[model samples]
Target: MLKVIFLAAFAVGTVLADGELIILNNPGSVHFEGSQATNQSFLKEVFTVVLGYTPKLTQPWDGVEIRDPFLLPEALVSIVIEGVESVKSPRGKHFPLNVDEVEEVTWQAVSRRLEERDTNNTLVRIRVGDGLDALGQSALGELKPNSVDPASLKHLSLNNEEDQKFIEELQLLRAIAQKIPSTVTANSKPDVYWFVVSGLRPVMDLHGKDSEATKEALKLLNDAVNDLSNAFTDIYNGQVVVALFTNDANKLRNTRSVESPRVRREEKAGELETFDAAAQNSSDNLNTIEKPITLRLSKRYSANYPVIFNIFLWFGIVFFFSLLAICIAIAGMDPGRDSIIYRMTSNRMKKDN
Candidate 1:
């Protein structure tokens, strides 16, 4: 039984050691409860900070028609015109447009002027149906074009009722990633999973009635993020680290709230230093105020010595049990040769025969 247990444990350890570490980059959508323009601006800033690129704005168009097969589809084309504008088509045709205009222009004409100052090059275009809110839909559409740098952008729908569960799962995957090693070799890089969540806190509080609800919501969000961190830690067996970035400092305040007084004082001092620097540099502007708080969830197992010692201890136990079992089996085999009763019985049986 002891041998079997040891073998099973050893097998499990081996499998975990050999298993490939999984890394995922899961970014949630930019959520905002504000004016359409405010929402768009906020989303642009988010993409700019997280992905390091700002996407150009395109006027909302109903439908587009593409004449050339080789050229980009008209649906994917975007035009930003301020007042009245004139566009020259590929067929040498001139078309005049008024302010806030939507035209079903040919792809050739659009592609020819794609590099122009006013025209915005979209990464991808999505057409929202009649029932959907166009502004909200367009905000989601803008995320992809802006997130072309670090990683591909995936805009998650905040309207899903099951978003809480999805967040929980993300947390679980992150926890798993934390247990695995970040780098397999000196040259090998660790897989990174990025979760970009936005608009968790409300932009305005009418009558200040929703304070408790807002706090609860923030708590839930923090819990989910923490859960993800813990899950990653367990999965990687303290290999992968979790880094959290948020514009709101309150979202991560709970993590420090439970720390010891001495630790909290240290953290507060660090935060004061950061604030002082920001103030001195005048970095707390409208665009930079919503800076992300990066929290690195490193491997909890700081050293390999303890883990190695534990492994050696288990191996010793298994070896000792195996040797004892072998000795016991060998001793049991020659019982009659060494036992007086057995020898007497054998002698009596021989005499009778």
Candidate 2:
């Protein structure tokens, strides 16, 4: 009964993606024709090429024919390049790029770069599952188990291999679906066709695992796929959707799981100590970190000198006038002869008399 539901869900997802393009990155068989390329250069080259060919989709079932590729005047498309560093330059030289900071590099700019014949000598053989597994693992690893609810902890914990696998699969599906909405809708486009660039390896690995983890993973993956289908359906309501698929889709779907040697060795070595240490470090960082306080001087209250000077000026004028009035009053009024002011006035009066 579960398998039946799974198949039905898969069928629905496949139908929804009938015209969508899936670009898979195969990192296992990268071949450099000329000089060895650095990770930075290789990434830039990949972005340049992939972005250039994204808009022009051709009919695969029929003879090769263009699918009416045209320029989008103000169509805002989001590009999510997974596994690549966000920084355009070396770190420390400038702030590292956050995932949220990735903005659209205009299709025109990409096309112009391609037209200039700015090609790299590296020829990477596109494989079935390139960076998907690593990306999925990273996403799952970043989850803080303690931060989640006790009920949610079981599903998120990596202590059990099966649980880890399930979480990885679910995260991979979510990641792909997330990239589309995050870039397209979050940035600009609301009702226009948006594109997603992702790897298929992690999603493919969902089939190979048969443990309880696999069951849970399948359920989550199905839900995510359904959500993506609904989202894209709404996005494609009145717009033409175009996607570019590279490499063979059959191979991508049927690819076997290749576990990283480092991951396997780490599993053999107890992860408990490492996990505890990491948790401690994170707790320490959080505890010791100070929240920044910003001080702002408002325009309305920032200027004090003018107000203070005005008050002082008014007080001085009043004081001077008060002193002069007292002198005039003393001259008009008479006091006893023993009074200092009276003696001075009498001496002046006696002289005048």
Compare the candidates by lDDT and give the number of the best one: 2
As a whole number from 0 to 100, the lDDT of residue 55 in candidate 1 is: 25
Error of 1 at 122 (Å): 26
TM-score of each: 0.22, 0.26
lDDT of 1 at 304: 53
Report the lDDT tens digits of candidate 1 across residue range 262-300: 111123311212222322343233223223223321122
352 Cα displacement, candidate 1 (Å)? 88
Model 2 per-residue lDDT at 14: 36
Displacement of residue 322 (Cα, Å) in model 2 is: 97
Runs in model 1 lying further than 4 Å from the true structure: 1-188, 203-210, 248-353
Span of ten consecutive residues with least summed lDDT in model 2: 256-265
